[model samples]
Target: MIFEMTTQVRVSNFDEGRKWYETLLNKKPDFIPHEGFVEFELIPGCWLQIAEGKPTEGNGPLRLGVSNIESERERLIKELKIDKFEINSRPEVPVKWGTFKDPWGNHLGFFEYLDKDEEKKSIKNNLERTFN
Candidate 1:
């Protein structure tokens, strides 16, 4: 059974890539099993890997969930010096989101739920399922 998940985003330089991710994630990686690869355990069994190498074209906008999209976007701009990106929202949609590129052009984004109760419920359910 597929019980876990891992996603990779490549970078041309290990040092710069790792630093960028550190700033974005707001912490050091959980695992550095080798010289050029680093892993962050984003959730219980969910992993985000940053490996040093050439980046793939059209790879991803690896969106992460946050509590406040605008605040997070501002943090990214102030901390990482990212360009101001637009946050999109719609009445039919339950969340707001925005995307930005890392130094190596790896697409990354943050999304925030409009409904805090639903977001809390989803997080609790996901944690329970992942851990139990």
Candidate 2:
């Protein structure tokens, strides 16, 4: 059974990519296994790896769950200088989301649950898994 997972994105330049990811995540990487590679443990067992290499065009919009999509989008615009993007949702959908691209053209985005109670439950579950 699969218990953990990782997703990777490539960048053409190592230093610039590392710095951009650090700013986007708002923290230094949890692990730098070697030069030109770094990893962030996004959730307890979920990892996001950024490596130095030729980036794959149109690879991903790796959506991260957030508590507030609007605020996070605003922060990205002001801090990372990303162009303004739209947040979308449907009546049956449980979350709202928005997407943007990094300097190296890697797609990244955020999603926020419409129901606050569900959001709290998810946060609590993740915390329990992290601490247990």
Clashing pairs in 1: none
Error of 2 at 83 (Å): 0.7
For candidate 2, write residues 1-132 as lDDT tens digits. 677899999999999899888988999999999999999999889999999998889888999999999989888888888999899999999999888888888898999999999999999998997787
Worst 10 residues of 2 by lDDT: 72-81
Judge candidate 1 at residue 1 and give its lDDT. 89
Residue-pair clashes per prediction, in order, are 0, 0
Q: Give candidate 2's whole-model lDDT.
A: 0.92
Alpha carbon deviation, residue 53, candidate 1 (Å): 0.4
Candidate 1's C-alpha runs over 4 A off are none
Kindly provide the TM-score of model 2 when superposed on the true structure, using C-alpha atoms.
0.95
**Which digits, one per residue and each the tens of the lDDT, describe model 1 over residues 7-73?**
9999999998999899899989999999999999998899999999999887789999999889889
Per-model TM-score, in order, reads 0.96, 0.95
